[model samples]
Target chain A: MTKTTGVGRPRASGAAASKREARLAVLDAAGELFTGAGYAATTTRAIAERAGLRQASLYYHFPSKEDILAALLEDTVRPSLDVAGGLSAKLAPVGARLWALAYADIHLLGSARHNLGALYLLPEISSPRLARFRAERAELKRVYGSLVAAAGVPGELLGIRTDLVFGLVESIAIVRRDQPDLDVEAHAVEGADSVLRLAGLGEPDAGLRDSARALLED
Target chain B: MTKTTGVGRPRASGAAASKREARLAVLDAAGELFTGAGYAATTTRAIAERAGLRQASLYYHFPSKEDILAALLEDTVRPSLDVAGGLSAKLAPVGARLWALAYADIHLLGSARHNLGALYLLPEISSPRLARFRAERAELKRVYGSLVAAAGVPGELLGIRTDLVFGLVESIAIVRRDQPDLDVEAHAVEGADSVLRLAGLGEPDAGLRDSARALLED
Candidate 1:
């Protein structure tokens, strides 16, 4: 009797785990569909079909297509901001912080390249939604701006001229993605170093080395 | 009788000149459409219609859509290459040349943002046609590489990391196009100067301003 009861409990636990996995599968399918096809062109039914789930089941997981996108953005953006903030707290000297920040950024972009494509295209399809996303992005930029300003460099003189450092990093990643023959990791590290140096960040150091290692490890 | 004959000839010449103007108008319309909608999305008939010409008339001027794009690329690419080549010729010392090259690149991008977008997007749609375009771009990169190699700066140490400099400049310009509020020119110049200094291109002579101006103006 005890053995029979234990077998039933294990089966019940497995069923619960599968349900969780299915939910994650739905989100992943939605992200890929939205990025590959323009957001406006993608539909909830399509995402559900791609996930091999009923449309009603997809709705059970996500209230709407926008909700799925918002989840993907949160998954990508929140960790990026958190990692950046944590790195900034630990690294001393403005240069080290900047380098670490760049590494974190590149890592985020590399992991979320597909989702980012959707994010970039979103602006063309839905301005109000893009505006909300940009607001979050702007907050991240403010953190970077403070670090640049604190480096005892005049913003104008440093020629760290725009508030688009993050955007530039992402754009380069897109180019690198399109060119598979190129050594993308090398490009990302070198590109990040160049931009940091441009912002009046002094010479490269072990902190940068560590940051690059950490970011590239995955 | 002589005065009457002169009037008739002048009118004939005027009509011929008007026909030439109409041909140019068609080309311009086709270019704008191709740049906006891409080569694949644009149709010869649509281009002809936009130009206020019969579809058959477009063939009289150009063979196909590819021809129109080729014409646009040829017209724009040559002047840009010339500007880059001209800068390398004028600036003495590798560091100054590097700075001038960066500024010239930014200026070129600003003027040809639409063309650059088309250039970037073409690869995704047509690999065979893009091959020739990529070859031209690779030659440009080779020119930059030669300039860096000629600087006699050891690769192991100071100076713009030659492999990454061009990528950095390209990324910045791409980002600036998406964010119009940014001061791309100033940032590009400063970024170049910093890279040069870091790469050990010692600062230029203050008194050389007159010589620099003369070379540029000439």
Candidate 2:
């Protein structure tokens, strides 16, 4: 269901292709404007202009500016959640699986054209429109917590460790936002290492890194 | 200079005290609105209403909403920077010093009535009006980097490690924003421990915690 391109829109092949193109354009423009000129300041007209579409056309793709934001935020977390879900079924060590999740998540945040994860801090995101995005994020956080617990962090403060691991990985977005010239690959390793260390798994050894890489590839 | 209340706003003692009170009211209102409804969505009029002041009175205290935002952002970082600066001169284990800095930072973020540090993610905060805040934040990051380096993290990725440690500490703001019922004091210890671990210091021992407490008390 989540992968459906258009279940209700009946159109010719050419029309459908063009509609998808316009939708992507709207998303790209909204991503830039929302992350650059603050979400509240970015008008639908401005997004339409940036996307090279009429305002009405932009609304045809996204019902409102909040919808655009929801799409962008979902784009940021969906891949990470997918990875986390897949990793759960794997037979690898908890530390290795956690490292893979962090690495993939960091890479996703760093490679985004706009730092959309930073938008998570925007107060407007608390509105009901973004509830799905919030729930997905909470699910991802829960996955991180479960993984950290499986990694056997010896403490009465395991919940805190879980929170720190999730926060540390998400912090990559702010790092990328501030340091546009940062080396994403290098930082991804550091982020994953920090997550493991925070979970009391210590640094990622060569074997652990190799195992994480294998899991990621799988 | 940063501590000066009002160098040029010379008024009668009664008027000056009331003006100072108004300025604080403006800040308080801005903090709530900006962190709740978002900076771009908030207006001077709304802030004035929230603070029980006329719009003109609001302008008398803050020339623009951007100025109000800059003040709030500065409030979030100033105490942490001061604590980091003071810790630098203390003769103690680098681990303890770093722990003290992290604990203080986490405490500050958790204690704010509104999650103003989360405002750092707003795109509008990139304006020139916030340059001083940005510079101060960079200075804070540099301090964290220097402290992490001094803590003797090995490998060619010291810069990455430094960024992660700093990012990890700041991510506490997001943690608090998402989980409002969190235990600030217990999580502060976890935050500090994660910083030390990320810097390769391992879990903070009791001696390290005691030393950090002493430094914080001082």
Candidate 3:
């Protein structure tokens, strides 16, 4: 596999690489540009140039810049949705499950090559192109709500707890924004613990934490 | 006092309101444009136009768009800092002080005329123009730190807890970005409670709540 450069290649063959590789390259470049220069500032031409693809070839992969942005946003949330789905299948205590879900979500946010989560709230992201990503994130939030509710919060407190629990995990973006040398592994542990705390579950039992860890490991 | 329109005026007299009001109008327009159209997309001329000022007049108030943005950013955090400072002078339980600080900060974020807090993490905000706002926010975070410390977070958990506590309060931006009809009062209550929970001080005492309320009311 030849290494892909982030920019400056003009060869048609470079962009003409297998379609799958080209698509991933476009997403990677869009993620960086959107998170760094911001969504509105990053034009498709810039994204194509950054991806080392001619404008036409980049178009072949993504019809519009919003399409590219929507795809990138999906990358940020889909993995956690997948993890939540996987965890729901297996039997586990609600606190442990919540901990496991948060751990996996924070790990993904912290470990992504780019700070894609920063783009999650960009004003431009509400376009129709992002409908699927919105649905997925809302689904992810619902998963958080169920787990938080199971922790036995009063009905009135449930909405805020669920929002805060999700917010605590996504705060990794805020952490990563300023702390360049973030220790993702340590942050994942502490962040998940914090989520559990906001859910009204104080310290996770050692056994419950292990169970959460085991679920995540699998 | 004359009500100002958000757009569509070329009157010199309107833009020539007292320097203080003109400055405020510029900041208000910048806040709306920056949070709605996004920082990179919003031009200084657009802000001036929105504020009913000629470009030259807007420049007289804020030398650049970034300066306008920096001023708006300051508005989001400064009131909370003032509240925190006031609470510090009054005798109150640490947990109550923390709750009041959180409540006041969350209220400012939610009740602001514009969602200025949404611009807190904009990529454009890192410019030198925002240095003062950054310093002030850092100071506010330190106030939160001392209060969280007084709540007895151990040395090891101090950093993450403080970050999460701050993040929880700021998460109102995220909430407001989605829910236009947000009940800011109810959210301030719930958000402050969540902050206490994150500080390891669950369920602030009713007496403590009253003390915090008294501090804010004053």
What TM-score would every model get versus the actual structure?
Answer: 0.70, 0.92, 0.92
Task: Compose the digit string of candidate 1's lDDT tens values, residues A63-138.
Answer: 8777777666666556667867676556365666676666667656665535353244233323354445556666
Where is model 2 more than 4 Å wrong at Cα? Answer: A1-12, B1-12
Stronger candidate by lDDT (2 vs 3): 2
Where does candidate 3 stray beyond 4 Å?
A: A1-17, B1-17
Backbone clash total, candidate 3:
0
Top candidate (lDDT): 2
Query: B120 in model 1: Cα distance from truth in Å?
Result: 1.6
Model 2: per-residue lDDT, tens digit, B26-137? 8888888888887888889999998878999988878888888888889888999999878877899888888999999889988788878788788776799999999999
Q: Is candidate 1 or candidate 2 better by DockQ?
A: 2
Q: Which interface RMSD values do the candidates have, in the order shown?
A: 5.3, 0.8, 1.3
Q: Candidate 2 docking category? A: medium
Error of 3 at A15 (Å): 11
Off by over 4 Å in 1: A1-77, A111-126, A158-160, A163-168, A181-184, A211-218, B1-76, B87-91, B113-115, B118-126, B152-163, B181-188, B194-216
**Which digits, one per residue and each the tens of the lDDT, describe model 2 over residues A48-94?**
99888899999888898889999889999999999998888889888
User: lDDT-based ranking, best first?
Assistant: 2, 3, 1
Docking quality level of the chain pair in candidate 1: incorrect
Looking at model 1, the pairs that clash are: B158-B199, B159-B199
